[model samples]
Target: MYQKNPNLYLKNQVMSASPNKLIEMLLEGGIKNIRLGILALEKEQLVKASEYLLKAQDIVSELRYSINTEIDSEIPQQLIQLYDFMYSQLVIGNIDQDIKVLQEVQKLLTELLETWKEISVAG
Candidate 1:
């Protein structure tokens, strides 16, 4: 349902939206920032990468509880697993590992976003 118009769901749930919706938006934004951070890091902008990555992690952490409730159960579980992998990569400071985890996170979120879009359009 959400494969066609992700903007609908994303726009409908910005931070100004209800708490539950806000969490969902934060999750999407955080994932986006993570990707941005990786790109920044690739460009050797360590400081920028650190700033963005930290913010993304912070947002995700803040919404941990709410996300568990508002996100699709399967999605959250996959995110949890990915988060663990990401955190490990962060600790290990492995560029390859980070890239792999980032790819997985992006893929997962992209799928969910698409699903939301499909649902919005169908409804």
Candidate 2:
């Protein structure tokens, strides 16, 4: 009997994912991190909150970097701006321990994730 390694399986899944799928995964990850950050904030766990928020910021940065400005200039540019705004808000939220800011970011991420899901289904 052969057992599959979870790490290897996940790597393969990511390697084989379509562009839209990858974006969806990133959005889901960002949303998860934001939710965790909000939870930490509510618990007054400043260090954990900062770590989670920073992780979410990093995910948004990855999303921004993955965008192809050459392919679709306007949309990618808009996404870049939106990601930048989210990153800034995450930074401020972490620094100030603001759950409200995290909530706003979470809402944006949820909407974007839903939109990406729709686009992926259509295309």
Candidate 3:
């Protein structure tokens, strides 16, 4: 019984993914961790909630960092601002034990994910 390591599998997937696919993966991860954070907050698991929120913040940060600043489009600036807002909300949600803030970020990331899917499909 040779079972693959889940972490290794995920690493391989990321290493092989295209730039657009990587964005999709990060957005999905952000949503997943925020959902986990929300559940942890609901359960009163403050430390665990903090951990998940931190992971979500890291994912959002990575997504923001991946954007190209040299592009003359307003989209990159908007994305940077959005990621900045999401990161701050994550911090506030963790500190205040606020599930609503986490849910807001989750919804935003989910919408971004859907937009990415449409772009990939149309491209």
Output the number of the lDDT-best candidate: 3
- Candidate 2 lDDT by residue in tens digits, 43-70: 9888888888899999999998998889
**Candidate 2 global lDDT:** 0.89
The per-prediction tally of clashing pairs is 10, 0, 0
Regions of candidate 1 where Cα sits further than 4 Å from its true position: 1-15, 67-97, 116-123
Q: List the residue pairs that clash in candidate 2.
A: none
Off by over 4 Å in 3: 1-4
lDDT for model 1 comes to: 0.62
Name the best candidate (by TM-score).
3
RMSD of each: 8.0, 2.3, 1.3
lDDT of 3 at 17: 100
User: Regarding lDDT, does 2 or 3 come out ahead?
Assistant: 3
Q: How many backbone clashes does candidate 3 have?
A: 0
**By lDDT, is 1 or 2 better?**
2
Compared with the true structure, the alpha-carbon lDDT of candidate 3 equals 0.90
lDDT values of the candidates?
0.62, 0.89, 0.90
Tens digits of per-residue lDDT for model 1, 1-123: 455888776665463586545545666777787788779878888777777777766665564444464655698776666556545444333244365565565666566557655755676
Runs in model 2 with CA error above 4 Å? 1-6
